[model samples]
Target: MIKITFIEHNGTQHEVEAQEGSTVMEAAVMNGVPGIEASCGGACACATCHVYVDPAWKETTGSPEVMEEDMLDLAYEIRDESRLSCQLRVTPAFNGLVVRVPEFQA
Candidate 1:
């Protein structure tokens, strides 16, 4: 299992264990981490799963694809480390990953 830390806009921290091969968005939603709406599930059609990847974990998580990049453009508070959580597949190497939710996602 991988450990994912989700920081909410209100500065709340929620850490949960996620199985490998599951999307970060799925793990967050399943564990009630909040802030991850996943409006289109894991299909990459919605930006509700957007999150800011901690700079320290950026290298480990890598960059998103062109499609995911396009979707992020529609997200609020877009940042240098912004990513669509649904596009991030969990792996053993991703354990202890940290992602922060934007203040606005509507």
Candidate 2:
């Protein structure tokens, strides 16, 4: 299992263990972590699953593709670390990964 920590805008932290092939959005939704609506599922059409990758793990999390970057433009409070959770696949390498939910999403 891959361990990931999701911190809400209000500082509520949800630590979840997910399958290697699953996406971060899947882990959050499956674990009932608040703040990730994932309105468009993992289609990359909506940016409701926006999150900020911890700066220390940014390289490990990888960068977004063109499609994801485009969609993120419509997300609220876009930042250098901003990423759509649906676009992030979980892996053993992501153990202890940290993501922060913005105050609002797209």
Candidate 3:
């Protein structure tokens, strides 16, 4: 399992273990991490699962695809680090990934 940490807007932190091939949104939802609404599930059709990837892990997460970027435009408070958690697939390289949930998401 890959370990990931989610920091909520209120500074709450949730550490979760995710299986390979699963999306970051899946892990958060399964672990009941607050702030990840995942309203569209993992379809990348919505921005409810938005998160800010820590700079140290940004390279591993990579840039969003065009479709995801378009959806992100609907997310509140988007930043260079903003990402749709549903679009981030888990891999060994993401074992220590840390993301922050925005205020609007919480």
Candidate 4:
């Protein structure tokens, strides 16, 4: 399992473990983490699962693909660190990854 930490805009933190191959969004939803709506259910069609990869883990999380980037364009308060959690597949390297959820999502 891969462990990931999610920090809400208000600074609430949720740490959860998820099976490898599962998306970060799935982990958040399964663990009842607040702020991730996952409206498209990991389909990469909605921006509600958006998160900001911690600068230290940004390289490890990698960059989003064209499709995800396009979708992220619709996310609220998009930033250079912005990413759609549904597109981030979990891996052993993500054991301590940290992400920040926006206050509001589109």
Model 3 has a clash total of: 0
**Local accuracy of candidate 4 as per-residue lDDT tens digits, 46-104:** 89999999999999999999999999989999999999999999999999999999999
Candidate 1 stretches with Cα past 4 Å from truth are none
Q: After superposing candidate 2, which stretches have Cα over 4 Å from the reference? A: none
lDDT per model vs. reference: 0.92, 0.94, 0.95, 0.94
Looking at candidate 4, the ten consecutive residues that score lowest on lDDT are: 1-10
Candidates' RMSD to native: 0.7, 0.6, 1.1, 0.6
Each prediction's TM-score against the native? 0.97, 0.98, 0.97, 0.97
Worst 10 residues of 2 by lDDT: 85-94
* Model 4 clashing residue pairs (backbone): none
Tell me the tens digit of each residue's lDDT in model 1 across 1-106.
Answer: 7899999989999999999999999999999988898999889998999999999999989998999989988999899999999989999998899999998884
Please, what are the lDDT tens digits per residue for candidate 3 over residues 19-103? 9999999999999998899998889888999999999998999999999999999999999999999999999999989999999
Off by over 4 Å in 4: none
TM-score, candidate 2, is 0.98
Model 2, C-alpha of 68: deviation from truth (Å): 0.2
